[model samples]
Target: MDVRLFKQVRAACNASTEKVADGLVGTIVEIGGDPLTVRKAKDRLSAVLQKARNGVPQLVGGPKKGEEMAVVISVRDLAELVVAARQQETLGEALDAIGFKPYRGAHILVGQSRKRERLKRSGDAPSAATAN
Candidate 1:
């Protein structure tokens, strides 16, 4: 497995501990196996992650005055999720927790983070307001 990916797993493990006390919920997972499993998991993980990214949204029409905007979970968030489901139970449980669409193997199809897009006004943004 790539070193960076391993680091990500470690980070996920840490976050999981914070989120649920137990490092990883469910049965104790192995998180390790033959090179093929690691490779496949990583590949599937990447594809699933890419499909979750948001490209600036509809720039053509610009954002609606007050419409909700789509937001993709960060790579790190996905990593945390994947690590929580490691080698024991299937990733389905983790994916389901996060609202990912059903997928084969350890892969999951995640949705955007999505939230209301507040209108921006001159000198009225939160950052500006906080500068008091």
Candidate 2:
């Protein structure tokens, strides 16, 4: 993707909520379908792809209600999303290294086992014997 489009995608990915990100990602052509609509979409696939390349994503809903939806975006956008996802994974790893643990979908600083041991040794925290 071009620099501008990449920036926009990055911002969208970083948005706190998916609903907020949807707005930042630009136009979304939602295809909620019947068989005829699906046929039409197939015939216009090239045009839809071109639109996606230009940063307008297509959200194709599943055949049945309450099923998952699929998004059609350019390969470049897909690559950027992969990179963003990896970055998030790396961030989670780093946070874990620094004594943060995942708690209820968020990270909480619960000091590492080694740190807890040191604190116990230094009389900063109660020992197991004392707790009982």
Candidate 3:
């Protein structure tokens, strides 16, 4: 996988959607859903990490270690993001709507292809993948 490309996409989305709150840096924490999913997973993970650092949330009836928190992201979250973006009449339009500037068809194609690759890797083949 192109880690740089992933970073670029992640950075772009983060810059566009993240916001500060409660005097803290908080990005929109998407759970097992799209961009709009509740930030509970992220928040829970953060809480656990924070508590561990503070030596809190003491484990009971077991080792004094921290309680394990499992926050699994579902393939549906990614699918919904792609579906939401692709709902646009055109790839260019969709990218633009997502705050991504697409200068050429090639760029849009690349983006779509990347999304397809992610879906494939996710093992939740989207219907669009079968259409073409």
Candidate 4:
């Protein structure tokens, strides 16, 4: 509906995670049965976006749904989710493939997994203890 508002919502969702990680924010205590923490973070973002759609003030919710509990997410979680959804493609392409025709002139944030930080396995790199 409100394209500009949607952009704000997306940015807010991404920022919410940093706040949580820094102990500056909290999330709703009532878990929605999603064991995966990543999903939980995404859900929180979704809730925030939903509230925005409903005319509720974005970030109005609290960490525990106290009147308005905003979701807590991390940069890693959001990036991973975006990558999984778009997979080296842009948001428009992904939407087109999924048959989601957005509102004319609506601008969706293009998701592109251009780079990633790889986790080195124990055997992949020699530690000081392992090195002579």
Compared with the true structure, what per-residue lDDT tens digits does model 1 show for residues 10-129?
Answer: 445326444432322211122221112333435566543453353111101113465322223456645655664463344765565567875468767699987988888976766855
**What is the Å distance of residue 81 in model 4 from its true position?**
1.0
Cα lDDT of all candidates, in order? Answer: 0.40, 0.56, 0.36, 0.44
The TM-score of candidate 2 is 0.40
Error of 1 at 130 (Å): 50
List where candidate 2 sits over 4 angstroms from the true fold.
1-37, 88-93, 97-132
Total residue pair clashes for candidate 3: 0
**Compared with the true structure, what per-residue lDDT tens digits does model 3 show for residues 30-85?**
21122222344354666544543442221212122553223232344434434543
How do the residues 1-132 of candidate 4 rate in per-residue lDDT, one tens digit apiece? Answer: 223323333334335665533332222222222222444546676775554344333332333433434443444444544545344246765575668965798587988877878889978998898788
TM-score of each: 0.16, 0.40, 0.20, 0.21
Ranking by TM-score: 2, 4, 3, 1
User: What lDDT score is found at residue 14 in candidate 1?
Assistant: 25
> In terms of TM-score, which candidate is stronger, 3 or 4?
4
| Structure candidate 4, residue pairs in collision | 17-73, 26-63, 27-63, 28-63, 28-64, 61-68, 61-69, 62-68, 62-69
For model 1, name the residue pairs that clash: 71-113, 71-114
